[model samples]
Target chain A: MARTAGSSGPRTEEAIRSAGLALIATHGYAAMSLRQLAAEVGIQQGSLYNYFRNKQEFLFDLIRTHMQDLHAALDAALAPEGGDPVERLTRFVEFHVAYHVERPQQVFICYSELRSLEPDNLAAVVAMRRDYERKLSDILDAGRAAGVFRLDDVRMATLAILAMLSGICTWYKPGGRLAKDAVREIFLGMVLALARGEVPAEAVEAAPPPALSRRNGVARAGAA
Target chain B: MARTAGSSGPRTEEAIRSAGLALIATHGYAAMSLRQLAAEVGIQQGSLYNYFRNKQEFLFDLIRTHMQDLHAALDAALAPEGGDPVERLTRFVEFHVAYHVERPQQVFICYSELRSLEPDNLAAVVAMRRDYERKLSDILDAGRAAGVFRLDDVRMATLAILAMLSGICTWYKPGGRLAKDAVREIFLGMVLALARGEVPAEAVEAAPPPALSRRNGVARAGAA
Candidate 1:
């Protein structure tokens, strides 16, 4: 109930959070034990209780903190409200790739271990995720309104763009063949192209426009 | 080592695999014990060993089988070897979405539980995955050679495309507002646009082309 009594309390809690993230990322939430986590943090098993009431709470805190930090960082990184949607989208892609590329473990745990969260915790995390998604969705909406982007379905595009950016976390290495800057630039080009609906004129002529019109209907109806 | 000794052997093995997928999907590979798996399957713990020698093997088999089936299905679904890259890319997208949509549990486990596989098993699975990526990568390469797809980096494009399509599994629900056909069409459109290097003319005109030339150089050197 009360904070662990000492100057070392916050430091120890930070250690526990780091250790828990690594353990859960490696073995998953259900497979990670409080005892194992405490051992990893070099603390007594009971001392974990001083930081969190139970494992669910601990897991929730880890993910919630990650989302909170992400949202805050995104807010700081984004182009200001009412700015050009292109600039905002560009900033979004750069921020997302840079943020995710540096924290692959966090991204991995946040996505993969989401199944381990309890119902309420899951709802909270899902809500946070939706809020995060809405930021990009809003950018797409603005781009569409400004006649700068031509997306068939903004929501689908949002999910696809987010997934594509986040997927970088799965394989990106700090000292890998491509530098972070190069990766970011390449992805930026792709994301901007995607947002702009840059399909070739010949391809557009080749395929029927029914999917576009239908998707527009669906998007307007808020069905997808 | 030997079969479970009856017509029921294959049936029971199928049951174990189903239950194992559900359990691992919900609780993860490490947290799923042989006892729990057997209990779920209404068999004795020892019976699991009749099929899988250990949990690691069980996990490995689950992912490996998924990859094998995916490859086989993909091979069947792809356009003929010398066909148009656009058509091949289209088929790849449809096949991927269809295959992965019906098997979210398999997709989740294949990505999440890779951490649970032993090193050798991991390598085998990784190789299988690389082979899958190559299917998509080769299509992009062929498109590039034909001057149909103007990708900055074929490898990056391949990963991005796969990540975007596979991401549908995370949020897609059967009987949801969007039909599978519609979702597939939308994704196909986006992937085609991406492969075609469809950035808006204005956006390209606005931004410096340094990234493009650099990426082209990198792509030519096979550096990315």
Candidate 2:
């Protein structure tokens, strides 16, 4: 008899990955056991080693694959070289929101389980994260250079924007009040506003905008 | 013989709370043992029962206390009644960034460990979070009514602003390249711009801004 897909090696590996993500996300890394993971995957305890060397490698593989796939998708989604910075940034916001909205589990573990990775593994994940961040930073820089975007600091804006967009995964539920496209549109507006440095007229007149403040180390009012 | 403050009941409770926070932050809620927690606080395992009935209650107490304190602090920090929405929003931004930056561990556990909370505890914490979110929502609503701020959906805007500010706790390090004051200011700009519906002139020209699209359910360009 021909072998079924479910019993095949690749299918088994995928099941292990999915089950591992669910376990780690629920019980966290320190609490999860290979024995439990094996049971969850319907594989013998010893056979689990055929998929990965150990739990640490399994975790590293999960995160690395997520990041790699993200980069590839982002590269494909981003606007072409020499494109308008506004266009590029717009694409970025749209792409980021759409991507993160669908992968809440992966997103949760990626942020929460970073501490579980070993030193070298942690370094690799952080480097990959930085590489991802630089993609947005470059767009912001280009926008600033072109005078299409006004930002006090490109690096800070990159982090802020990523945080703002990635945050949707925390609370967003499918069939919730807002659809994904609505979320994308609203976030896109906010991101563009941020890049363009648009403050309401009242806010602008009431005080010197923080972006315009020249004093380096002196604290702003109410900051204390 | 006089008793040391560290040995006093209140001090001991505080120590337990701190140690519990550290353990849960590192190992997550499910994995952390009460025995380990007691050891960390330098108390007998049975003594932990003196403070809380069980691990679940202990977790709830920590989160509820954090939420209560946040509410009290926010109430104190917000601008006076009938103040300008711009002013009120500014105060909210400043207060949130300052508050969350100091309590990364608490902020982290509040977000990451919500899954571990039992049904009632989770509902209670969620309600507290909603109450907190409404404070910001009211400010945004007032701003829109006064024509000082523009937003498509007040609730979504509230969540976005909170997410953006809370994100600082993840990456912010004291004595880092940017001071807390600088981060507060930069984030303030982004939040205000988001509220004001500020879009770059170039971005506005390149496409119909998402905020302006009249279509309710139809997908936007490139969203597919």
Candidate 3:
């Protein structure tokens, strides 16, 4: 549903969406303004209605478009023939790391700003997110059942893993020492380490009871 | 650093911080008005300034208090005497899960609203968070150096692990299917499983080198 700016049509639309994403990302959804967005796009305030009905509509479009784009990218990355489930899952984490790291602005909106959408739009975005989460849950479940991964309670497992991936957006700044793939590779290793389990010899001596230690990357500190 | 409001003083300060935390958590910092916070505390708008210099100051104080509280609780739980790094670290995870689950609003503010703090205040908060992270890192290092835990890179290891723990806040609701302690126990189990590097032997035929197996989670053409 892209409208082309015969001359600078796409440019204006892109500008509007980019400004909206940035504003919503830095300032929460409700705090974002049509006035601020228009100025950010170098357009008069009223002109915004030409492209979007209102701020809510603009946000809905932004959330929908960004989620669709992410879903497509992740699906492609995890194509059936990609590799084994473990490798594909690692690729998914890598993709998540790259998406959150490279497009921090978009990532923030997809997360914190989706709430700004009106009821109908919010439902749509929620459905999309649920669908995506289901993909992760299924992958984990299959791995668990097939003896590829050993996670208990796939639902919580998926949430924990995705949360860890989303966090890449919160802290990862590209220019810092680690490149995108470096973080991905190590995180992949960590995920696999958790999924596949750890050193067998060490397990014999000190493995805590299963009920006490189920999470992977986010290790807990002692009680405070 | 509390000044007495006589008998009313301590309670009023508590009311103000609690109100500020709740407002900032739901509506966001920009949208939370001082007048609203005062109303929430059953005081006149102007009286809030007595407890806090301004709205930002109120938010600043709330955040600082939360961080300090987390530090104190964590220190109390991880008292260096009871257990090995694994058990100590597991207790830490359980503590985080329980605390964050019980106080979802504060957890939301700690994760989301901190960005809105003025530079100086933000720096203070960041320093506290960094200190907390370092404490977790120290445990990991202690475990690894002692030949108990194995990890590729200590820094990456720490971030990935802690992110998983804090990540719980985003999804936890006060009353749901999982109880706080149950979830915490699961996290502890998941992590300790990883720490000892024990994959359930059934998952792989030949040990999957480095990583065990890729995710088998994608449920294509099943739900949509």
Candidate 4:
């Protein structure tokens, strides 16, 4: 009976966690309050205690939820094929962009505020983060094994790629100037050029863009 | 008498601004106060009013000082020395890495906290950032013109490179795992490989590194 109640409790916990995630993403964890979170969930402030112990606890649950969702989503998105690096990379890119666009709040909060968690929660978040990074590094190493990508420092390459792609969150909004599809296309194209095994010196053809502000890679949230 | 006072005043003002820059770089701008800034300068709190109108004015002045430093530094660093596009690109990378490593605190604060500025300050920062980016875009364009580099999209390419180098602050501690020179070499090599106009489709020679740590790239103040 206890196990059943505990398992079923996720419904209430999920709603509370979602509210916390959205608030923390926009305002940063330092500024969010439990009162506002409870209000957003349409529950009495006291009822929130059923899901989380305090603001810190609420944030912990949200970070954990974001991490678990990300891991599960990435696994679901990985292509069935094993050794093909480009295919694996392309799928990784697609999954990342989709996940970020679909759940911008979760991604943004997880990235920015997970460090503010309690000791145990911080440990858990750090572990989850290491797991994700290792997954990316594994993909790159596998590509090296399969002779698909080239790098002197695979660690730095992974970090660079991760940083560049994650930067999408900073400028990307739901109804931005560029369509999400175009943004993905442009980003994918740039990565492809970098990832290609042998781009001859003659192939560097960066053209002057129409205008910097209207840069096509600015992805809208829903369209892509 | 007026001329001497004016000259000394400019020097003293620069000293105060420099001192504030160092303080804000480590403590964060929001958490820091104008009172502390005045104390750091050996001036009474009221004297700060004479130098700048108010707290926001003083903060804006610090940001503008840093921005001017950055713009001029990058411009001087990337002057089109007579060389292959790869060489020019290497110079740019070296300058970016060297400066970031040397002034890790200033670079870190400037990148991360510029967002917290008021609307007017934020616009000024955005414009300065755009100016720096435009110079890089032009280099990529010129590289294309010279047929020394291959890129899919110029604007995205610029962002990718900037993000990659900007991320050095997250990992490159002045006293850390890799020495400054080694970090520069590794970073430059990977960037050159990307910029050299040949996509390195072949995998790297080493065993796969462990998965990367994703949380590393997420926050501004957690470089620890």
Clashing pairs in 1: A198-B198
Residue A15 lDDT (model 1): 94
**lDDT of each residue in B1-224, candidate 4, tens digit only:** 12333346666687778887777665556546778887887666776666888777777777777779988888788666676566677678788888888877677667766656789898988899898888778878887666656654566678778887888876677677678887776677656555543431222112121232111111122122
User: If the candidates were sorted by their TM-score against the true structure, best first, what order would they fall in?
Assistant: 1, 2, 3, 4
Give one clash count per candidate, in the order shown.
1, 1, 36, 18
Q: Write the per-residue lDDT of candidate 2 for residues A5-90, one digit (tens) a residue.
A: 55889889898999999998777777788999989988777888888898899999999999999999888877355468887887
True contacts kept of each: 0.39, 0.37, 0.21, 0.18
TM-score, per-candidate, Cα-based: 0.86, 0.86, 0.83, 0.72
- Model 1 misplaced regions, further than 4 Å: A1-7, A200-224, B1-7, B200-224
Taking the tens digit of each residue's C-alpha lDDT, what string does model 3 give over B78-163? 76555677766766776778788788889778878776788999999999999988987888888888877766667877787777
**What's the residue-level lDDT of B113 in candidate 3?**
79
Chain A TM-score for candidate 4 is 0.77
For model 2, the DockQ equals: 0.26
Candidate 2 scores an fnat of 0.37
lDDT of 4 by residue, A1-224 (tens): 12333445668677776677777776566656667877897666777787756777777877787789899978877646463676667567656865676676677777656446667888989899889888878878887787777655678778877777777776678676544554554454445445553432222233322221222221211111
By summed lDDT, which 10 consecutive residues of candidate 1 chain A come out lowest? A213-222
Assess each model's interface with DockQ, reporting 2 decimals per model: 0.34, 0.26, 0.22, 0.14
**Model 4 chain B poorest 10 in a row by lDDT:** B213-222
| Model 1 chain B weakest lDDT span, ten residues long | B211-220
Candidate 3 error regions (>4 Å) = A1-7, A81-84, A198-224, B1-9, B81-83, B196-224
Better of 2 and 3 by DockQ: 2
